[model samples]
Target chain A: MNQFNIDIEHTGDYAVIRSDGYINNLGGEKISEECCRLLESGCRNFILNLEKSPIVNSIGVSILIELIERVLESDGKLVFTNLTSTIAKTFRIMGLLQYAGAFPDELTALDEIKKM
Target chain B: MTVQEIKEIMLTVPMIPDMELAVTKTVESLSRFIPFTGDQVDEVKHAIIEACMNAFEHSRSADCRILLVFKVGPCKLTVEIVDHGKGFDPALVEDPKIENKLFKNVRKRGWGLKLMKHLMDEVDIVSNRNGTVVRMVKYADAYRKEALNESV
Candidate 1:
């Protein structure tokens, strides 16, 4: 309900980050910072749940792209779950789909990430 | 009352953080009268936000103001975002690809126009030294068509 809020849950194998509210520059930076901290902790696989954060701008998405590149550099995996139609299409248009995966929910995304 | 009336709204907000949400709030009100579906509404909000962010980040307007006009017609919505700042040529903006953004060194903040174009049915940009105007349209006709097919 805030302008932006991020909640991260670390499972044994991967992490699930739930994002809520509009994703602008500040929101993106927050997400990036969290992902960095997770990466430093040796959590490579990630499933980002965006159900509560349906609205996003290009700047925020660009930061996601940056995160994708950084994770790929480490041979880590990233997937998105609970994305709206527009978000999925935007990812496709921006070619993020080529590097990451998008599923209907966290369980599906987790299944996919495990195979990666 | 013989002719169809077009519902319209004009709003002005300062170029600051989170002002785009104000414009989208107006859009939500308009969508109630229009025929846009949930997906279409999300696309419109996203496109509008991108436009506002582009101006907020690059326009550097003296007054730091953004002007938005929403015109609602039959099965169509047209939005124009204007900023009275030094503008650049839209043709000169480099098309960003994920390949380059992923492997090579580049800034990742220039995907605004691309997003607006893809999300809207039509998009036209006019820019000069005085200001910039981004006019975009989203038609509800496609939704209507799908609904009609479903009913058939």
Candidate 2:
């Protein structure tokens, strides 16, 4: 099944990527590409909305790490919002939580990013 | 002693990352018949994804295939993922948890094996000149008890 897609929305200084599917290799690649595209457009801050994505593999997590690195290189911040409990736990185990912050909703994430 | 239904499923898929969804979904569907809690099901799905992804990534052969065998018994569920590719010793692989540098990097790979071992009740990896088979098991009774205790 084609169980991965993303929609990008620009809000002032950052872009929110709403991902709708399992975040595996396919989903991860799409997210990385979208983030890179946005980075080139001078959008450094990012809020990744993952409420629709309940599952993510290590490959997908690795891809997210790459995005985090890219954002850090640009002195930008990448935050995660609307994470399922499973994904949140996985991210914590993989050390993604150390490099990024996760909020319960997108508005909170956006508010935090705006302050940064 | 208790008598419980036993069910088995066999699935074969190409060695590609995108096929992970199909494998996970099939396992989730079959797990409904068993007594897996929501947390247990998530753990099972994560472990299965890692096994399948490892097979697809490590198997350099263009025509490599992955075989999944799932067996559900009275109190436990076991899944075996077999891949036809060059295998490495699981013992030789360093634990990502022990290696603090790996966790610090965040981008460092090798979390797959660690996660599979952590999520499942038991994990066995057998690799030889033929191929590698990763067998993982989860105990329904244990998780069910944990869930029940949490609700208490």
Candidate 3:
């Protein structure tokens, strides 16, 4: 399948990336590329909307890890919003909840990002 | 096997279009017997994709092929994925209850094994001197019941 479809939008310091479809190894590559694209545009804060994305493979998870690392390394932050229960569990199990923040709703995530 | 059957079925292919089908037609033949819902089919597809990609990405070989064999019986469906790469530790795969925190160091990526275990009723990984093969099974009735309960 075509990894994932990415949509980019900006608000203040945060760059929101909305992705749908299977996020596997190929998906990870695309996400990484998009993260790089926004970083080049000088946007650091990120909110990843995975609500529409019901499934995520380990490779995709790894990419998210790398993205989180990238953000943390740059002294920024990454948040996940609108996550399906399964994907949310995967992230939680993978220890993503420690470094990254997850919001029950997008407005909440956006609100938190505004405060940051 | 029958070339005709292989051609007619949805065989697994690598992410790359140009290469020969990364998995064999036998793989699909085996899948026919395994009982899967639309959702399960998607999960198996994702699991296979992750496993094959691990072989293709981590190993040196560029054009390697992974073989998937599906054996469907009256009550159960079994999938066997064989790869031509050096195997790693299955122990390293993370537990799903480890809390919501990313592990630092990132010495290895092994959540794929964990995914397989969660998706399949039974998962067995055998990595020896002769490459690696991961086997998974799903029961038709049990899956249906669980899926029904979840939907309700």
Candidate 4:
């Protein structure tokens, strides 16, 4: 099984990152690094599709929070899509849902971001 | 080993990277006997990860080892993560907030214990100069009550 990998696709103004595998510290850093590249290129909207990568530790989730801070500082939007209920609940408990938007899937997040 | 001994799995892992994953793999094997739902197993795995990470992060074990025990009970599965390292006061650990961590220069990585406590049904922490052991329990769902009873 793939330990951690990311497939980034830029659709119009938003970027969709499909993650496959466990979101450990390294996996989290990969997502953050990819987002950093997108941010530098002036992409403001992000859709993190974690349909395949559902499991995450606090360290990895903590990195996502830091990413949210960076994205917010840049006046950009960061949203998560296709989160397992376990991850959704974990996000809620960690107060991540407050900082970042969560949608059911990539299409929904992209549509919502387009509306914004 | 008796049948009772077979139900209890003890693992000792070095304090290295990705050791938590090893524990999770063993946990998956244990699921054959315990009817953990998809969500419950994920919660258990995540809690185990947090507990192991806590040992690696805070304990600073001189021996660089973590001892884990998985016990199958009548209605619950108990996971114990033990470390022989310098322990800190859980009371002193600050509760991290996104609001405080985002804009301000505060720490944002103290959610391990909170996540473990939230994921597991019950969490007990015993820490001192000797070591720290995080004991987490997950009660089986009512869907398969007799399965566990018959197995144990």
Instruction: Say which candidate scores most in lDDT.
Output: 1
Fraction of native Cα contacts kept in each candidate? 0.81, 0.35, 0.38, 0.81
DockQ of each model against the real complex? 0.68, 0.46, 0.36, 0.68
- True-structure Cα RMSD, model 2: 4.2
Q: Could you give the interface RMSD of each candidate, to one decimal?
A: 1.9, 3.1, 4.2, 2.1
Which residue segments of model 2 deviate by more than 4 Å? A1-3, B1-5, B61-63, B97-107, B141-152
Q: Write the per-residue lDDT of candidate 1 for residues B76-115, one digit (tens) a residue.
A: 7889999999999998998888888886788876888888
Q: What DockQ does predicted model 1 obtain?
A: 0.68
Worst 10 residues of 4 chain A by lDDT: A1-10
Number of the predicted model whose TM-score against the real structure is largest: 1
Candidate 2 vs candidate 4: the TM-score winner is 4
Model 3 stretches astray by more than 4 angstroms: A1-5, A36-42, A51-55, A73-75, A103-105, A112-116, B1-42, B58-63, B73-75, B84-108, B140-152
Q: Please, what are the lDDT tens digits per residue for candidate 4 over residues B1-152?
A: 33433578899999888888888889888876776788988889889999999898888889999999999764568888999999878888777766777777765678988888888877888999999988887877873455435646
Worst 10 residues of 2 chain B by lDDT: B98-107
Per-residue C-alpha lDDT of model 3 across residues A1-116, encoded as one tens digit per residue: 34468888886677888888767667777877888788877788888888777667676788788778778888788899988665666676567888889998778998997787
Clashing pairs in 3: A95-B101, A95-B102, A96-B101, A96-B102, A97-B100, A98-B100, A98-B101, B30-B70
The order of the candidates by DockQ, greatest first, is: 4, 1, 2, 3
Name the TM-score of chain A in model 3. 0.92
Q: Candidate 1's error at B72, in angstroms?
A: 0.8
- Sorting all predicted structures by TM-score, with the top scorer first, yields 1, 4, 2, 3
How well does candidate 4 reproduce the true complex, by DockQ? Answer: 0.68
Give the Cα lDDT of each candidate: 0.87, 0.82, 0.65, 0.85
Global CA lDDT of candidate 2, please? 0.82
